[model samples]
Target chain A: MVMRGLVCLLICLNVVGVCHDVSAGMYDEEEGAFETVSALNSDHRFWDDVRLTLSHVYAYGTSESGAIANRSSLRYEFDTTFFKRFSLRLDGRSSLYWKQDHQAGVDDTNALAQNDLRECYIQAGFDAVSFKAGKQVVVWGETDGDVINDVISPRDEREFVFTNLEDARLGQPMVSMDLYSPWGDVFVFVTLDPKVNETPAPGTRYFRGPAGIRVENEKPDTSDQESGIKWKKIFHQFDLSVMAARLRQNTGVLVYDHSDTYKKKYPSYWFYGMGARYATGSLLFTLDASLKRHYQLQTVDISGRYAGSECLMTDNALGVEYDAGGRYTLNAELTHRHIVNDQDDLAGVKQDTDGLFIQYRRLFLNDTLTCQYRFYHQFQEGHTIHNGELDYLFSDHIRVIMDYTFFRERNQRSYYWTYRNDDRISCEIRYYF
Target chain B: MKKTALICLIMVAFASAAAAGQAREIMEKVDNRNDGQTVIAHVSLTTFRYMTQNGKTRAMEQARIKRMTFVKKDEGPREKDHKSVSILREPKSEQGIGFLQYDYEEVGKETDQWMYLSALGKVKRIVAGNDNEPKTGSYFGSEFNYEDMEAYNLDDFTYTLLGPETYRDTDCWVIEAVPVLRKAKKSNYSRQILWIDKDRDMILKAVLFNRNGKKTKIIMSGNIETLDGILVPRKIVVDNVESRRRTVLLYETIVLNRPVDDEFLRVRTLTDKGYRERKLQEFKDLK
Candidate 1:
């Protein structure tokens, strides 16, 4: 039950304007700024390189005419090294709220706050090899926003695709090793504990489960261990990487027992993926493909009985990015997915799907303000989503981001049909210290 | 009579070629100066938009400050071939952000770059960025573009001696450089005029012109100090003519010839936070 996905955009310019004044007060004139820093740089202090951030987000629902969310978050991050080879990182965050409004039927306790240990790792390097162990997030993909090969960590899908992938990712415990070589770099990882995605829980928007159906989880224990390996090489004008992993499914496959309950299970599967990127002039091309064996898929019959299907899943994407020199940038991606062994009598979901995603961005006012428009269309389901956002950097330590999203669906059987009315606006402010 | 005329033509050609060679020799000497093999420094950049009043430039009240730690090491004897990494220390929003670059001098060899985005918690390989836009083609929103920060490739331009003049009470040689065709396509400046302190073999001032032959930026380097028997500029300022913005770069604490591990320049520097910090702390401890 989280509203982080529907990052509604609101124009709280007045509030940011006030914060700007306060920030200015804390900032001094340029004449003596560096002069003061010169003395400080000579000394080491406890908070010298430590970082803390304060953020607030407010969202309003247009379709439901209600307050979707009002929350504040504090984040602490610090990293240090000692003994030449040993290093540690401690990063954590806490989400809370004050003077908040709760939407009807929304579990305020669960929906408002979503906090985590974003990343905390200690690594030791020895010449050509390094080992890191802790809670960490690893990204291994060429496509943006879409997951093809970047599936090492579970994602928070409570808000569906509305939230940015960066914000949705959840770091898990793992021990990774890297071997740097002249030919290429090799990476290996073993998950200490496997976890599943955070889906929409009860009393939250986009929850399509049967009314008041009891939910249960069948989690993986120590015996269901998973591991992965990757090889990356950089060429003259391009880079390529290939990886394979035996990982548990991130999505929970629901199983109904004919009783008033549904058991969610994450089955283990084999995943193989490859990614490559090429850059020439101002244009860059990226490609990623992944194949999953024995992927679990679920379907519900008209009688409300759920059945599980094990099929081979293949996902491919090609993306292109062009920057007309910092003033404007354009990115477009094409995706194709197939359930090779899908059942012909399957209901609701399709066996194959194709999608097109494009985003355009521009900068203004000495690059302090940015405007972006992102759109994605599902060709098979005829589902579409448009998101527009403005990010303003008031200062080095303060940023305000406002965004609005609109979702449209033509096929009721499509998953997007459930969020067709989730269009809304939101405003967020972040201050770093 | 025809033989005499031929002799004069040959003499003129030899003189002209020698003059051109002399200019290149001077630039080569400047490039070959022993600044340092390894450098570690704390850098501060203060920037602000300014307005011209009564033939004088006055800085506006609003100024932005950015602090970072710059580490660079020369790869070998080749020119413009080195590895550099900069880690942001201030602007808490961007703290711990690191940029790593490997500049190569081989023809047709592109520079390799990577960035560690703390917010995303990943290391991302970057492309040759900001080739066209002058407004956003800057280093950390400063007046110094990547080109300005880069070491000049002697082969990229043709140099002409513009005679000597006394600047700031020091004897300096004025030189004009026009970019070659291949470099012009990727360069924002069409020509550059540099004031070099011939004796010290250092750059004192530079005025750069845009592709349209309009003077776009004025750069001045001063506060030279000798550290570890190498001349270093402690303060440098850049003034943008078109945008009326200026940025001042000051080295708060700098040390030269610091023994840096070879592995520190690898991609791991951008990805491994603790290792980077640990390796840097030893150097940072030195005043």
Candidate 2:
């Protein structure tokens, strides 16, 4: 009942947002003149390069309790450019859920399955400066399938990593400006309201803790603000960038208040990061490093006990990509993270962690079909995730995709081991116009 | 006999000097005719792939459209640098895709290329084996590759006057260009033969040979039109002899020496549709 109310509220908000934008459009003098000129002089219209895509996805998987679950979703995206210098985009999705048995303790139906507004943004550009305002996503970093320095935006972890990382990213309401110059491109962003990553709710199948354990979420006030700046430049065969930001961390740690209850607290922190890429011949090398001050996280012990802690953390990653031939590519990356100035025992807390990622892709049939495999492993915990996908484009506007993912852990007490039994296979078809 | 030998030596020396002078003069004319400070063109490309099925010939076609902007500047007395951006506009799947290139005429320097993938909304730097290697899949699966689109650098190849001939009713100077040792290691073609129009100072046709001395590709340029004091080919066709595939590029509009802002060449323009379209509008009417 509560989820349905939220859905209805979002619908009403969307309607109001559309009406406001349409009313605001009438006051833009420059855009109006530009549209008139375009219509009079050329075949070009104010609305150009409009694109729409419809997609359907289906997945069948078994939970840890041996209950079979089926999930289906329909998604749509609409994008169009207007007045030569402005664009508007929208995306939404609806889904259906089913389970073989209601006795498995998981809900057989989801009331909020059809409620999602993925992205809505308006973009405009001038001679040297460009602006984008509304709900949008800004991505930073070069490594594939790994998060080392990409911390600017929040993410949705409700479905875990099964969804494409790009798709799982939730847009934040922000206004951003990019100033282009020969020396470098500088970006400034101001977010109106801070947003944290959304993890699975307490009653969902993906929830990690024991059932009946109450989970309390403590979010920052809507008035809280966040901002960031990034400067990127390209010199000869090298690309480099540096960024600094003050924002609340997307993922919060859980603190066990007592035996049967936990509290999730989101804390704000400062992050400084730098990244570089150099290309030579068919090989490209990348490096990224970031330092976070006053990082807060929860650590889990072997006995499932959780404790909260705060410390400074440093993360560094190096990656390389090689094109073997016309149809094959290989990529690998190594990341190391360490906690600084740690004074507590924090037995379950990950004071140090190292991870390696490898990926291989091959294309066939004039690049109409692509097959890819990716593997990620954490050194200390012996946790590994393997993913493979095959994508085929049947035509210019239609594509089919199939993917499988598996998670494993050598240490049964590790955090990743909690999902070892939830491997899944999914297929999707997309039509673009 | 001694007098005769001296005379022969003098004649041979004169011929060698004349050949070298002629080659340099022809290259200078070719360069002068094609060089421009800035150029923008809107083009339509059609690719045809032929196959023999059941002893009958079959053909398949693919079409693409793009707008290209090029800028060249003299960096030094002997050095030239160029930057070009090509944005794809047709074939909905490839719409908004873009390629940016930086080429330097200095020896031992490699060209740089970056590709903007619209689907990913990201710009990726392309690193090939050499300047001659294709940046992507044969320039949209056509017979032409990325290297084929680059303007020729006189210093990279040694030219020989193959003599005068008439091709398609036009008087032409046949020239053969062989890559220098340093360039041969990076080049895909062992030698290229050009049919330069004697009057227009443009290459009318070209034949490329592989390292094994086998014919690999042939390109023909036609429908020459003078625009802004420069001869521009309205139509260009490239045929791959090995695969029996061909690509034809038709220039719908050609604008030379147009004012192009430096901001239009930045990475942001490639990723931002509005920025790219706005910049392109500056030259859209050239057609």
Please provide, for model 1 over A311-371, each residue's C-alpha lDDT reduced to its tens digit, 9 standing for 90 to 100: 7889999999886754587999999988887456465557888999999998876667889
Question: Which residue runs does candidate 1 get wrong by more than 4 Å?
Answer: A1-42, A98-115, A301-304, B1-21, B52-57, B76-79, B129-136, B259-261
Off by over 4 Å in 2: A1-42, A45-47, A60-86, A91-115, A201-205, A222-224, A257-259, A300-305, A324-327, A343-345, B1-21, B52-58, B61-79, B128-137
- For residues B80-179, write the lDDT of model 2, one tens digit per residue: 6777787776544466678887777776566788888766566888775544443434675557776587657888788888899998788999998888
Best by lDDT: 1
Candidate 1 per-residue lDDT, tens place, B1-287, comes to 99999999999888777767887888988888998988898888777787757655565645677788899988766635888999887777677788988888876776777778867766666666544333235687788877788767889988888789887677998888888887787788999999999899998889999989999998877768899889988777787879878787888789988887767887777776666666776785655
Per-prediction TM-score, please? 0.88, 0.83
Winning candidate number (TM-score): 1
Clashing pairs in 1: A8-A425, A8-A426, A9-A425, A9-A426, A10-A426
lDDT of each: 0.77, 0.71
- What are the chain A TM-scores of the candidates, in order? 0.87, 0.82
**What DockQ does model 1 achieve?**
0.35
lDDT (Cα, 0-100) at B149 in candidate 1: 81
